[model samples]
Target: MRTTFLVIVLLLMRNDAWSFVVYDDSKIWNQDSITFYFLDGTSQQKNEVKRFSQLWQRYTGIKFNFTNKKPSFFNFKKFYKISFKGKNNESTNGAINGLIQFGNLSDNIIFRKTTILHEFGHMLGLAHEHQRQDRPNYLDNKQLVTACMKNQQQSRAWCNENLFKKFYKKVFIQSEYDPNSIMHYDISNITSKDSETNSNIPESLNNSLSFTDKFYIAMLYNPKLDKKTLKKMHKQDIREQQQFEAKANAE
Candidate 1:
């Protein structure tokens, strides 16, 4: 989510981690240990990734195994997957087998840990809190579109879908609208404000998870909760959500 490599040169805004979590149980990694195979990166860079990514492990009780195995067609699905040489930092959300394009960390020491942890949140399947449907309309649609098109060379539709898409919270949302969520982007610089008195800036360049982040991750990966318990919890989430929506419609 954090893109140290791209932030300085490309002016691309990166999303941080934590906050409004994607309550899709299928995306949750049920395994105790997740494997990562890096296709590119030096010892120091790889070590930095390992060291910083451990932050997620500490809270979730999930373990990461690192490797440099040359991926073959036969072994493509083995790793959780990562690449550190890309211009942007990105990752597969949640328990599925996917690649995390972790941006290079050779230069930006300041944002390195933040970038790792943020993308790892995506790797754990947490969506951007800024995009939550429950959030107020903050980003200027016209201004944001112009910026993305001019600066990032992205298309109008791509900008809208990726930058301004609203995620309806009909699914399981274990947390609230945390502006400080790591999965949020600092949009003050990217887009114009809706009102002069208001700004969409986060309180800080968050480097750690919020309390709700730790709580929900702990719940998802709790050692005591077997698969059955997790299933039941997800079912309960759905039932409550339906009741809440129905009550709202009635009102």
Candidate 2:
């Protein structure tokens, strides 16, 4: 049964159309405090996730409460349910649904931290950075397809079509292509283009949130910032990200 659910998740992760359905803003948790319940994972893993949640809370306005036993029926809707089953880690795009499925975490502390941070970004409604509409300017589709094929051990045809649709489809958002963002995947060997050159694309799987990441998250959660100001800041962030990517490629 667990294997079947994992397979379903894998399929869902590959279907970009399904992602659109999951990425609903109405699902975002509007409350200041949220609860989380662990259906699986070691105590250490749970602690790690809790720690990471706190790390994000420090930067944003939200708060987290971890519970060992499931909350009562009255509070069940108020808690996020987390499970460790799938081979690939995935989380519901926002808090309204309260479901997160994670894969194995490395014993290495740093690796585990980075993985959790990325997953939490998804929980906060952030999509993959590479899926940003502007990404094609910095990434080559063919090269990305090749990389996807190799990474997933799928056929070239499958990668070129279905996998590409699943992972690389353009997402419309108010943010830029922040390669340094924890939400960005490590595509160093896969990327075929960047501002400086096409070869030797710099790898970026951040262990922590980048400057733009912090700024964007703050903008997302802060009620003080108006829509116009947020748009302006997003543009500024794009400029900075472009400069950073260029410098990284030149190095």
Q: What is the Å distance of residue 245 in model 2 from its true position?
A: 22
Model 1 accuracy (lDDT, Cα): 0.63
Candidate 2, superposed: residue stretches over 4 Å from native:
1-24, 136-138, 152-163, 166-173, 189-200, 223-251
* Tens digits of per-residue lDDT for model 1, 1-251: 12232133123221332224774546766566788888887798789789877757866676888989854567533357778766667787777778888664425453566678788899888887677766656553556666655655667886687677776544443356776566776554334344332344444445456555655665556545455665655466446535744664576
Which candidate's lDDT is highest?
1
Off by over 4 Å in 1: 1-20, 71-78, 104-106, 148-155, 189-204, 223-251
Best by TM-score: 1
**TM-score of each model, in listed order:** 0.69, 0.67
Clashes of 2: 0
